[model samples]
Target chain A: MSQPVRASLWAGLYCPGLPLSAVWDHQPGIGPVAVHSHQRGQARIFQAGRIAAQHGVRAGMGLSQALALLPQLQSRPRNPAMEQRALEQIALAAYGHSHQVVLAPPDTVLLEIAGSQRLRGGLQPLLDQLVKTLRQQGFRVRCGTAVVPAAARLLARVGQHADSPERLQHTLDALPIDALGLAPGKQQAIIGCGLRRLGELVRMGAPERARRFGSALNAELDQLYGRQPTPLAGWQPPERYRQRLELPVPSERSEALLFAGNRALDHLGGWLEVRDRALTALHVTLEREDAGNPIALGLSLARPGFDRARLLEMLALKLDRIRLPAPVAALVLKAETTLEHRPPQADLWDGRNHGDAWPALLDRLRARLGEEALSGIAPQADHRPEHAWRWVPPGTTRVCTETRPRPTWLLPEPRPCQRADFRLEDGPERIEAGWWDGQDCRRDYWIARDGRNRRVWIFHEHEPRSGWFLHGLFC
Target chain B: MPEAQPLQHLLDQRSDLWRGRRRPQARCTGSGRAELDAWLPDGGWPCGRLVEILPACLGSGELDLLMPLLAEQTRQGQPVMLIAPPLVPCPQRLHRAGIALDRLVVVRAPDQALWAAEQSLKSGVCGSVLVWHPRGRVDARSIRRLQLAARESDAPAFVCYRRHQQPPPSLSALRLGLEPGPQLTLLRGDGPTRALHLGRANVIELAVRRRQSASAP
Candidate 1:
């Protein structure tokens, strides 16, 4: 029996102006901007914004030439590090759509979406959502889909789409020879050989093409046409999210700091969603103007989940309570610990149960009043009433062994009492234990009533100490 | 006649006005004690409302009065929070009272006790919230905030003030003064003040007596 094969679909995301957008996206409406690079001491424009391009500024133009065209042009040195980080962030967003995400650096992310197309309804909606997500992140993205990864990247670079092999062939044939991304000399050589369009060159026989042009060009053609498979390294997200954002102007107001903090938190939330993880602990550092030891605030959640609103609210609460020593110049958010996200199962009846909101409430309280303030109580097996209970983390439950009558409230330390102050009611329930742990206790406990008619737990020491002490209260 | 139309509309909107008819019943949870529930206007503890308990002294069976409700709430897998209790709550006693030890959250936030209580009450996740306020520390504004939060969530909140402190004027749905005889004086509620006996059984004595009886058999 013969089986049919499933064709794979690859979507390439191309960020045409990443070099300019990465630095200027946060500061829009600042007029035309261009990112330039120093090539052998001569600065050349690498990319230009739409307004700059409309003003006749093109890539490879000298900075002086672009300046002469538009005196109000804002030009910044190209930041390769920032561009790479932006590309990785785009890849993180793409990872949400497909698991097989390949990073094509200098600016493209290729996604294998054939396996997940059905799960996302269809290819068109998936591509639309992918573009919308990138756009919302303030990146200018163009998407192209094809059966071959190389063809998809090329199509995306030229702003075209080819969904099938035939469409890809049609699209590739109509392109000029420069679309091959060859060196200037090679492209001129191909054009001089009477091949102005790629269709003419592709129509030639493989051996003649290889003989005329070289094996590299022939191999490139084979990979683009899907005759040979293209193996690319897949991109893996980092385990932690640590990003610093500098404020445009240092300010003493906490609202400004919270605004910047929230932006970083949005990225962190997206990172967690794509990784299928929940953050349990976050450490944020406020960089001040005086360069003194930065103010560090750590937030720990009772339950791990990517709840952005709750996290932001807790951060706002912390910011409101803190008195900044100096104006903050930058904010750094770092989250290292995460757990695999296990979403709670919904109740069948749609009841108003805040089971999910419980942890968030605990988180908010702890964020304001520190972690030591919250605890749960559990019974210990010791016979001594004072040693019969211990504090545990909230929401922890354990099986408590049966015991004799104990007070509802146990004092931290037994207070000395006069024997005449209380009227005895219940007889003594002897408890003599804890001798093994160096703190030996021999006491006879009784339930009595104080003058106010309040039930009190009193004990009389028999060994090592002799006194009447009020130990607990019935209420 | 035109001026009287607006006046008539205002009168129609007033829910507390005496219409000389039976009003709609308020939602409540049974107080576990049948006699106490009978004396309450709602036939039980009011839900989603603040119930202020004023004790003559610490450990005047104030906590015992609510033990039954807390135990029932915990049994249903709902969380019960105790904010800044005057002393450590004995888990053995709570356990014997049929309360789930795991579902109990004890927060020692003495400074922000009312704040924590308000947050817990507003979160709607807790089954009940109990806050112990120092004498004369609570103000009318904070109590009003607590009352509003309690009204918004399903959790019942209990604010226990220290002994003999003058109760502040506030919007609490119910207020009771606890005395030495374990008696409850209805300071504020749907009805006027009345001394109601709270014949609460000491669970500790019951446990010890039951153990002895089982051993004898």
Candidate 2:
């Protein structure tokens, strides 16, 4: 394959882990503003004060302080997961538009368009299309392309990045060292030494630079130039199985709805048998025809398994709380986030299960028992007497988050099962936990049998209090 | 090029696949019951295609009309899917209709019932998929995929919609329109006996009219 020649383009790029903001009618009159994590200090040329920008209420500024800066500014907690997901989605979408997608660490994407130059008609027309797509999605996109991804990123930081100017070297050289997103202390050190420009840093010898600054500093520079090639190996989408239902009229009644749902589960079950794609989570969307937005419900799996009845049973446990305010017009179900698991090879057996003749038995139980009223127990991240295991929602077949050895019987809400009077039909198991969090507990737990020979795990807290609690039963 | 046969000859040959005629596929056979079998031209529905069942609203005896067929298919040992339907078909009532309760699997994909139907078809496992997407638009592409899936698995896909009227270029091999028709006045004056009327069981070579005259007017 021919190597793609680099050229200028309107690139909508962002660093997932970076904190960026666009103030109302944000103009490029001021200098660089570093969104730092520190408090009690301000950098020179700070364009927008922490108190001014929507979420920038100074690094250590409290929520009230930030709100006071801009009362109407919408606020949302900073979630690295949310940012990463959004970046991956946008990157995937942009990938379809451009074949060569450059993914940066944590969360940054680069689309190289040098090869598409001739077929792109003209630079302005291409820029217009790119701008339109990115702007429509409410993103404050910085469009620029350099021969290198780092150069593009730096140029993006400076307002000089644009589609029309073919002279990219000048634009890149004009951006300050701070635009490179170097660590703040390093940036200050470099600026103090009068090394303000990317050009100034590039002029230094490799050995001297490596000796003065660390390998990270020089690697970043090498990455900015065309000397190193960085490529992103895109992720393959998970295989999904889906079913749909359309209603003649809108409806909210639960019973009037299963006529179609039952059929979908039957289809899914049969499909699962042939391929054996172990399914765990299902995303069900209920679309109200008149309304464009659909309410999306995401179900997670506790175990890697596939059994339509168990899935429906788990779903039934949660469906009672679902309120369809308006009549539903359509139903879409997609089982996703799948894993690979195959049962031992068996004879070519043809099996069929119909509307589970008594599907209502489970449905009725689910309807009566509020979702959380039923659950299964899973091991948790503790070895303490009380924290060794936890009760999670039923049908959660996922591996337990913890791997602590658990005593069979745990009392529910530790009742005072008197040990002297506490039938010592069974022995005690000593336990301890909590090296961190400070609320540590040590206890002597006993699997004692009642006069009726019923087994119970009873524990007496050794410190802080003298109380006996019934933990659980052996069965 | 294949020779085109007249409607009678074509349907006569189709009797084997359509179930209405004596020469019907064993799998296509539905409702050994004589009265109901006679009422249904193709016995019930073809084993491997689409059956479009349109109802005006929910709880309108929609399930009652299809239960007989579902029961027959279950007896034949073919799997069935009730796509995300408005309500679960009554199993007890299905038992009353002579369907084997043990031979059924019910999936509940609340709103994406259409997607669920397509997914079931994609698996090529079930003999039938019963869906209810009342106002959903079943475009030509989705219908074609469903048809292809059913053919691959030798299973059938049935969609029950709350549609006011059927769209052009029907995706179904058999389309039935059930309306709250004239009631049978009996001592059991419970409700109107909704009847299936104005349906297209099969698409024959209905003559195509030239939109514009071939010659000048």
Best by lDDT: 1
Listed in order, each prediction's TM-score against the native is 0.82, 0.36
> In angstroms, how far off is A60's CA in candidate 1?
6.3
lDDT tens string, model 1, A1-475?
7676788889999998788876664544668888899999999988888899999999999999999999988888887777888898889888888889998988899999998898679988998898888787778799888899999898888888787899999999999999878999988889999998888899999999888788799999989988899988988888778887766457779777777777777678789887778888899999998898899998888777767788888888888778998999888888966666667554579654455778888899988887788999998888877777898988787888856778888999999999899999997888788789988888988889888778899989987689899999887
TM-score of 2: 0.36
Q: With candidate 2 superimposed using the best TM-score fit, by how many Å does residue A25's alpha carbon deviate from the native? A: 22
State residue A430's C-alpha deviation in candidate 2, in Å: 62
Model 2, C-alpha of A356: deviation from truth (Å): 21
Q: Write the per-residue lDDT of candidate 2 for residues A1-475, one digit (tens) a residue.
A: 9885554453536532233332211112322232333334432212233334434544555545545655643333343443454454445545545656655544456676655555458544654565565454324455566666666665545534544333655565566787888788888878887888877887889888888777778777766664565444644322456656554345776554553455445545534543456666667788876796787765555444555665665555455557777777766778863547743332355553333322332333334333343333444456664554454543233333332223222443566666665576545666777758786778886656554444445777886567887665432
Clash list (residue pairs), candidate 1: none
True contacts kept of each: 0.94, 0.00
Local accuracy of candidate 2 as per-residue lDDT tens digits, B54-89: 544343345555555666577677556665554333
lDDT of each: 0.84, 0.52
For candidate 1, write residues B116-142 as lDDT tens digits.
Answer: 999999888888999998545558888
